[model samples]
Target: MRVQKIWGADIYRDGGSYGFCFDSDDGQWYEFFLKTRAFEPVSPESHQPPIIYRNGCNSGEVVLRLSWEEAQAFVAPLRYENRRFMELIDIVMTSGGTARRH
Candidate 1:
């Protein structure tokens, strides 16, 4: 895996997907997810039910020998969740307020 710098994290990519190793406030290198270079989320609510695929902070880590399959698996869910959440939010915003159906 080749290492690169992304969002201040040590990123690695082997052809199909990208991986990263970054430090947290605890100062440990956890498994960082290979997020899409496409969209960047602005609100915390933006990263919901489907994936928003943020730029800096990802879902998980990018360990050694991180393959594309593994990366996609990690990334796919996030986008799905984020997008779903945003859709819900859009519905609420259009409704003009937040209220439980119950």
Candidate 2:
């Protein structure tokens, strides 16, 4: 599905990035990830959403932070929600939430 249409209902584009929170379809209490797409836009003044971050990282973890940033850092924004993205995102979200690993 087109990224915009799939989650556009809950997504917000700001500056050069697009972001969304893990809100349920009911739309409530969604803990948002600030500036989740860590890309520097190709078109600086085009107003188009930026691409995803380079291979995704936590931008160098601190003594109190993991390199993955607990999903706090915006990874590259996905152009399409393909299966690979699903799997990777599952890993990201699970690890971020400190949930039981599969």
Candidate with top lDDT is 2
Best by TM-score: 2
lDDT of 1 by residue, 1-102 (tens): 222222232222432122233333444444343332224455332211212222234543223332434434433333222332333333223321221221
Q: What is the lDDT of candidate 1?
A: 0.31
TM-score for candidate 1, please give it.
0.22
| Model 2 regions more than 4 Å off | 1-66, 70-72, 76-79, 96-102
**lDDT for each of the candidates?**
0.31, 0.31
Estimate the TM-score for candidate 2. 0.24
Worst lDDT window (10 residues) for model 2? 48-57
